[model samples]
Target: MTVQYKFPDNFWWGSAASATQMEGAAHEGGKGENIWDHWYKREPNRFFDGVGPETTSDFYYRYKEDIQRMKEIGHNSFRFSISWARLIPGGEGEVNQEAVNFYNDVINELLKYDIEPFVNLYHFDMPKEQQDKGGFENRDVVALFAEYAKQCFDLFGDRVKMWFTFNEPIVPVEGGYLYDFHYPNIVDAQKAFQVAYHTMLASALAISHFRKLDIKGQIGIILNLTPSYPRSQHPADLKAAHRADLFFNRSFLDPAVLGEFPTELIELLKEYEHLPAYKEEDLTVIKENTVDILGVNYYQPRRVKAKDHVPNPDSPFMPDWFFDNYEMPGRKMNPYRGWEIYEKGIYDIMINLKNNYGNIPSFISENGMGVQDEHRFLKDGRIEDDYRINFIKGHLTWLHKAIEEGCHTKGYHLWTFMDNWSWMNAYKNRYGFYSVNLETQERTAKKSAYWFKEVAENNGF
Candidate 1:
């Protein structure tokens, strides 16, 4: 077999998973209710197939076998997020020893197989009690989050060197406050911006504590960076793209990596009287505690065009006020979930970091194709998911080009290792190298899994 795109030595290769998404002990193991757990219980009809996060993949009881499978597939690194609700139930109180024991076992097990564990502090799983206290909207809750982060650092920092403070911090804001997809489902721009600000502040504070504690490992945050492309070269279209980028990508990227908010974003917020409440001294904390590394999760690109209609001043303030989504004619898309499949988006992101964001060391924290009704593709007890293999290869080719062009790209991790229950959608879109049987919990390798095994073992394909 010809290896046309060889990767650098020791390039990380595996997949990423979250505690709420995969680990299924939502009620047991002293794991209190996260927002997801509470939301699903309250509004069961909101979730697909009326399913909840009670038992998704059952990693709580089966992580040992899963770690073994990761080793079998030649995984050098794996990323999993810690459940804040589980670790410190109610978000701030006595630490749950059972939860601590479980995570310690999982980390130690991965190390036993020579698999490096990349642990994330939070992944949108705010404890229900904290949400009652206003979640990230309140600055006092922000301090509690840092304390929770410090507990994690002290508990597992020795073995888990690669620590991520938050995985896609902007997601909770967009989902919970701006949109109605997540818990505490409100639709207030003011609250959304406040949540976003507090989340970043919490991340910086955690980084400060990590440095002050002299943790002998790197700390970073995973941001889902969607490169906003203009529909045309027209000035209006370019402006729309720029605004979308400012709102989505740079909002979190600049503050996490550069330690400051974008001036333009601040001006826009001020114009609308929607600036989030913040103290003057918090900006200095953000400036001094930038991340040591970055995790870039690229799933697709955002194409925007100038709003076709004149704005109505009476309308509620929203990011959409500046631009409208442009569905590029003839763009490739994954029909399963109607998500655009733009491989070059990964390269564009890496080069942007190279040119604009100091080429900070980064990796593809999560990228993979999810297919619905994956069982239909099963042949002889294995899914012949050539589409997923092609999806990964296409993105890797672009990523390879970015590395050659001097981008500080490091590694790639798929969205998941196995078919885990997704949020709200439950298990509708399967994005995994291994197709898991929900009934028997049997893990069957899809075609892409074997293809990826060779790639990881050979350093490329």
Candidate 2:
């Protein structure tokens, strides 16, 4: 029996890309340096094969051709972020007219093809000046970000109807503060907590600004929600998984949608003396300005178990102090990205949002597989990425089930539109419908692109 899987009416069909990852001409068009630019200059060896953001996919010069390709692939919508440093060089002060013109042209081009533009404000490309001023650790940066948001609304709000305050807000905290992957790396739990808090507060402030502007559009935050699974039914294991969820997912999810931090998370932070220095006014802002929409980016599930060994009391406080990652036996895996493949995690996330977060309108903002040595899958001048096709189908099947069960999911956007430069990993893992030739900057559609075009045309598989 061939059972058709159909999405709801007006389900957005497209892919996402970030300015830092897509736009080349890193120093062109009167753009200011961002953390990526600074970090690459300081430690070029840190990035994969010494490839930095200086010359990514050249989206700055190729957006017109890219938009045309998007139209041909049946995309009714597209999502991309504006480079803060590029738009408002130095992260404050007067806007660069060239950057403004570039983005305006991109938005207009998307609209010309009947494609809705989902614009995101921030995507981990912090201005170097802001980073020097303590980045998110300093409360002043919050206001600065709000000002930038207001500028964006004033400039492009009429054409760009869907606005996102931040994409994966917790990622910077995790990568820059907890882990040492991102620039200005510091493994301080206290700083990480402060960064997370300020990001949530900044999101609220942006939402507040958006409402004041009276824009006829939806405003929201994009969160990468990883459903936590316990190793066993033991109380300790269950507690470990729950705490992991609180630390990673709900830390940003709660404030963005529900306008409050989880009680357990607050108590845990307080106990560890890791609570961020926040003013009463910031809390009020968060409480009053919940998101109008939610962008759920699910890539994997977190499997955790209770910590077996007590940490040294003198060591710095960390989320792993309460839980440890558990590797489930016989788990499906994406070896390239080194993440577990759990398709049902998408459905679980949707159900969680529906049941706990007022059933807020949401969408799969980023979901796709990254494969190393993708060229090996090429055949007859086209990449025969059947695995990628199956991956999307698996996740979409679960997403469709969630909708059947009454989850308010509005769309599904793959992690990216085309193969572009990643942060540190560079081009090691390809996760795009169309593969790009880094040497020539030419884009060739993969087998999955044709399959996805048909799926979008049919509204489902």
TM-score of each: 0.99, 0.99
Q: Write the residue-wise lDDT of candidate 2 on 1-461 in tens digits.
A: 13399899899999999999999989999999999999999999999999999989999999999999999998999999999999999999999999999999999999999999999999999999999999999989889999999999999998889999999988899899998889788999899999999999988999999999999999999999999999999999999999999999989898888889999999999988888899888889999999999998988999999999999999878899999999999999988889999999999999999999999999999999999999998899999999999999999999999999999999999988999899899999999999999999999999999988998899988
Off by over 4 Å in 2: 1-3
Model 1 misplaced regions, further than 4 Å: none
Q: What is each predicted model's overall lDDT from 0 to 1?
A: 0.94, 0.94
For 97-139, candidate 1 gives per-residue lDDT tens digits of 9999999999999999999999999998999999999999999
Worst 10 residues of 1 by lDDT: 309-318
Candidate 2: TM-score? 0.99
